[model samples]
Target: MLVNMKKILEIAEAEGYAIPCINTPNEETVRAVIGAAEELNTPIIIDHAQVHDSLIPIERIGPIMLKYAKEARVPVCVHLDHGSDYEFVMRAVKVGFPSIMYDCSALPFEENVEKVAQFVKFAHAAGITVEAELGIMASTDEDTHDDDPEKRVLTNEDIREFFTEPAEAKEFAERTKCDALAVCFGTMHGIYAEPPVLDIDRVKELREAIPDDTRIVMHGASGVEFDQVQNAITAGCSKVNYYSYMAKATTKFVADKVAETDGKIAYHELQEAAYEFMKGYAKDVIKAFKNGK
Candidate 1:
């Protein structure tokens, strides 16, 4: 069933698990992600990143995502990920996305709050859920969503500067009235320069301070250790954004499969095999985020 992101996240928060929010820029990935959720009988969120507009415009993929979501056996939320620009976010809304991340974290705190608060009012009136980011999330070279190459070299130490303050998180959530708030604790986007260490305590603090109606979100969960990821979920994160590593792994898997087949596999067959692999990969991700639930 197709549902709003807030509906699924409320359930996740109450059930002591986090929903895995994965980027599905293409048809294969969309099918694979929803297929995994159906097999596990769990709710999943499949998002289209604004950065991927170059690859496939939302106009082209939005209906397809919604169609798949409506047909899926388990609940699925079609979301707009990292929609920084107002016009781009409106585009997602126009395309009928049930959830949107109106990221203005790069702006001053007051400006970010004002922008999101205004959007939240309009979004709520339309019965759409809005997610806002409180802190700047660093990105690595492998993160295609981040166009700035300088972000790629940021180390764990550098990421600490971007950690969301618990008090500010509460204020932001309260002021904006966002359904979910993505906050930086330790993880950075893409492959980590070093094994990332999550500020589990920070997660707990943010959870306690933030309004109950606003679920806490953790972005850049791809390269973090499973145990740490689960710990964050237990501490408070009800929505975890994961991708970079999964995409990298899929590429390697396809390459290896072609080599094993000695280049004899047909193109369609290769695509099918990749889809199957991603389905299984997404299943493991969902299970991990379940935190043993």
Candidate 2:
């Protein structure tokens, strides 16, 4: 069933589990995530990032996602993830995404909060839930491996000054009135070069400081282990965003299948194999995120 993102996250928060938020750019991935969620009987988030807009334009993809959500037995929320472009985010809201994540964390603190506040007002008026990030997350992806300093691991001083402070997070939430808040405690985008050291303690603090009903989102969670993810959920992460793992799973499946076929496999069969692999990956991830619920 199609459901509000805030309601789904609230349920996860109450149940002490994190809902898997998958960035899906096509129908295959969309079906994979939703199908796994239905089998698991857990709520799921289907997210579309701004960078992927060209590949799966909102005009075409939005209704397809809404249709999938409506057909699914389990709850599904169509969400726009990391929507840095104001016009594009508004377009997503207009296209009927239940949730929209406005990523303005790169801006000055006050400016970020102010801009989010403005968008939150507009989104809420349209009966759409809003998500905003406070701390800047580091990236290690192909597009930003070398140039972006924010992509590096969070230093001790960075944690204190750059990442979301519990007190400041409370203020930001209260002021922005966002339904969800994405925090950068100690995770980066893309595959990790070293083991990630998450600030589970800070997650606990943020949970205590923020409203109990407000959803706490953790981005850059793709490569983290299940145990660490469990700890984050225990601490208060209700929504965990993952992209790299799913992409990797699909890509690897197709590459291996093609090699095995010696270029003789039918294109449709290869696509089916990739889709099935993605579904399998989604099932495992959903189980891990929900602690085998």
Candidate 3:
């Protein structure tokens, strides 16, 4: 069914489980996610972005996602993920995605809030759900550098600065009225060479501090660690994002399957193979849910 994401996520939260916000590029990824959700009989969030569609258009991807979810027995939420551009966010909503995310993490905090507030207005007015980010969640894809001439790691303060108090987040919701919040919790995007660490205690504290109804989202959240995903879910995280790993799994599978010596491939030709890989990974996540809390 074409269900609203806010409702599904809240249901998952209250029911003592988290909805997997799986990244999808094409039909195979969607199918994989849906297959996993259906097997688990759990809610699923299928997320996409313009950055992702650098090859596959969102317009083509949207209907395919909606169709797969509608056909599935479990609930599904097709969400926009890390939307770097405003136009793509609007386009995703227009294309019938139930939820959209505005990633202003690159902008200064004040500017991020202002920009997110404006986007929230447009999204909420259209009866679509909006997700806003606070705190800097660095990823290899975006800004992550050192001061001077050395590479450095982000500190706890840097992570904390990206977050607003639960009250402030609630007020932002009241003012901009975003439907959900994505906070920085020490996880970086792309891949983590030294392992991704999420402050579970801080997450619990933040969750306790937020408004009861506000959904907490985690971005730069992929290649989910077994313990962290479960712990975050226990700590009031409703939506858990998975981007790089799943896409990586899919892309790698497709490349490995291409036996052509010419190193040439067509889109759909590879997408089919990629979809098979995505399905297996999606299934792995669902099975993880089954085995885990």
Judging by TM-score against the true structure, name the best candidate: 1
For all candidates, the clash counts are 0, 3, 2
**How many steric clashes does model 1 contain?**
0
Error of 3 at 130 (Å): 0.9
Best by lDDT: 1
Task: State the lDDT of candidate 1 residue by residue for 1-293, as single tens digits.
Answer: 89999889988977999999999999999999999999999999999998889889999999999999999999999999999999999999999999999999999999999999999999999989999998888877444546766657777788899999999999999999999999999988777878999999999999999999999999989988999999999999999999988999999999999999999999999999999999999999999999877
User: How do all the candidates rank in terms of TM-score, highest first?
Assistant: 1, 2, 3
Off by over 4 Å in 1: 142-151
Model 1 reaches what TM-score against the true structure? 0.97
Query: Which ranges in model 2 have alpha carbons more than 4 Å from their true place?
Result: 145-161
Q: What is the TM-score of each candidate against the true structure?
A: 0.97, 0.93, 0.82
Tens-digit per-residue lDDT, 1-293, candidate 2 = 98878889878977889998998888888898899998888899998888788777998888889999999999999999899989999889778898899999999889999999999888888778888998877776665556765655544344444568999899999899999999978777877767777889999999999886568899888888879888998899999998897798678778888889898999988877788899889999989988766
Candidate 3 global TM-score: 0.82
Each prediction's whole-model lDDT (CA): 0.93, 0.85, 0.72
Error of 1 at 139 (Å): 1.2
